[model samples]
Target: MDTTTYPAPQHRTATTTAPPPRGPAATFALHLGAMAVAMLLGMLLLAPVATALADAAGWDQAAAGPEAEALVMAATMTLGMAVWMVHRGHGPRAVGEMTAAMVLPFAMGLAPYWAGLVSAADALVVGHVLMLPAMVGAMLLRRSEYTGGHAHIRARTAWGRAVEAVAHRWPTLLALGLTFDSWLRPGIPPAWTLLLLGAEYLVIGAVRREFHRDRLLAAHIAGFVLYLGLAAVAATTPATVAGPVIAAAWILHIAWDAALHRADRVTWRWYAEACAVIDLVVGVTVLLAL
Candidate 1:
């Protein structure tokens, strides 16, 4: 993911910037238990809808079944995880863990369904349905961060608010523009999509120049180079290869966006969330189209 204000890559402990600790064991248990329940629910609900969509779209089960199933699994997981991250106070530490959950069903469970060895219901149920409780819990915890809610999670700081504000503005529209292009055109190469992301970085960097000069430049420079390199890589890679790369880059982009805002390097914090969502939708669209 291209980022204008990326964090210096570093190790972050699980408790680093999270709201008041529930203790390592307790925190882990909370997400695990809640996610399990949520997954169960989401599976029951999404499975039927997915089947209907697949039928209506005239999906070739034997041919594009894996891709379709994977798409469904990944989209649901991404949405659930992103929602969880937001409600969870947009905590940096929890983002990776939650994001990781998005892949479990796509990589493992969906394969069995493609092979006719498992039902879509079973696969999706095991994939991200549990994300419902996870998001609900996180949202409730972070509610205090906003209006009426619990007191465990702290409200965002002044810098955090600013970063959110900035991110919610143009960056979001930028993602939407890219997404619309991808949807409408359907054949724009990954290189072009990524190059646009580089352009976005330039715009963000330019915006940040008005503030702290030193901290923003190095990251922006690195991000520009990285995005271009990725574009080159995507240009040569097959869709099978490029799809994952693009999806991963988008996920990483979402994470870095959060990290930046959390570090107060951003003025508004909404861009990361928007980017994550659009990336998820766009990434799946590309995967399926391919």
Candidate 2:
């Protein structure tokens, strides 16, 4: 050797680097894809329910007119999108924007259609065309969100979500009950109402052993027995007596439902709320009929 020692070749270790964040275009595409999928899935999940509600309400889309049908369709689509957006860690602002994007287009077009400036077919076509631009606008308003990594968290507690879901349906439930009353003419017999009330208590009492152990159960049982006796009396009595008894029973049950809902006892709060609506509506209907 030349008497000079060369430094040993420096050893180099390669350090891996994370891939860069997706570009804006890529992010936009990804969000669009996810939204498309979510919309599809939401439709799959919610369409049948919407259809059933429409059927229950006797919507008769053809007779109700295209605008009414379009409104329902828009609502269903928006609700689906909103639900998916929430699941994807979107906040309320994003959800609301998306809802507006889906609904506003269709809703706005109705004014022109009603003014006879556009035919029904033209209004529907324009609405459909506008939805994409509206949705894109909503996305652009929150560009950072779509570009950023998703945050997989829910803003609401399970109970809160349950209540929200029920809140949306209470109006529908009331409508359904009223529709049923319309169909049933004079409504179910008073005896049948008492029998149904007892059945409801049975469900409430059977849901948990804690309910059975509660002292309130004793009163509930007594109420159940009293209902049975009253049912028997209603079955045997004249319309004059049966009508008032049934109306009174329905009115009393409305108060009972309110109490149970406030106490958050026995049955689900949603069920109690629904029962109260049904009780009040049916009771009022009975009173009006009388």
Candidate 3:
């Protein structure tokens, strides 16, 4: 009777939506940040030992120091980063890709060296240059290998996770690349030169800011310019004055880096942190040498 007039019950289905895709700018920042983190840890844990490694690997002879050390930087950073990529679920493919980046440079440059077509210095320089493209290209390929925005693997130990976090960044590998590259400059590069370039750790983020007209651009540009002027002057100044000037530049630059990292102004803030540590190490060493 009454039930016969009642309408049939309706069933409702729920729809799930995927998260919004990150915008281009955001994507860029995320990638840079990843690389930065990788670099930061790389510098702190491995970069300093690169030189010693070069020496140990039979790269210590005359005219080979830069090349040897550069190779060490590339190998160390590549191996370190690959280990993390693997840790993050990238597997063997990542290891091969990353190692290829280092191997190609050596293959190309060393061929010339053994042929006597180039000096060790020249070959190392070629290798270093070759490495940039190889590493960057390998990193681009990594875009496909990354999953879930990064794999989630639980480390059995805190130290294992810490090591993983440090090793996972390709940016720091690039930064360490820069560190080794800087050593290739003629005459062991003045303390001021290293300081200036170390300050350049901010340049990547600075450039990224250029697109959005970030006000920090002016400060970054102005700082670089001022560094150049000061560096030039330090080139001529007595070591007594130059040492302190270089010291101030590096020490102050590290402080600036920490500040920007805090502000999230640095593209590779993680990279900057690593650079700061390296700066402190080098700055103290340079200061003591002076």
Top model by lDDT, which number? 2
Better of 1 and 2 by lDDT: 2
* 13-127: candidate 3 lDDT, tens digit per residue: 3322223257544654554456445534554557656654556688553465445555565665566556555444544556677678766886788787777788777877787
Residue-pair clash count for candidate 1: 18
Worst 10 residues of 1 by lDDT: 146-155
Ranking by lDDT: 2, 3, 1
Report lDDT per candidate.
Answer: 0.55, 0.69, 0.60
- Candidate order by TM-score, decreasing, is 2, 3, 1
Per-residue CA lDDT of model 1 for 1-290, tens digit only, reads 87679668885433245353555455655655555544444444455556656666897544664556667656544544444334445544444445554555356666677688888667766545544454445544544332322232332587655533443353453455346545544543456687666557557657766335675666766877887888877778887777667765654565556666676554345665566657665666665566
Candidate 3 all-Cα RMSD: 10.9
**Against the true structure, whose TM-score is highest?**
2
Counting clashing residue pairs in each candidate, in order, gives 18, 0, 4
The candidate with the higher TM-score, 1 or 2, is: 2
lDDT tens readout by residue for model 2, 1-290:
48987889964433222232788789777777777665555555455566667777987766777687677667766665665565555666777888889888887777799998988878877777888888888888888767667443343578646634543564344334334533345554547779788668666667764364567787687778877887888898889888888878887888778888898877778678778877777777777777
Task: Indicate the worst ten consecutive residues by lDDT in candidate 2.
Answer: 11-20
lDDT of 2 at 174: 38
- Candidate 3 ranges with C-alpha deviation above 4 Å: 1-78, 86-151, 168-188, 191-206, 210-229
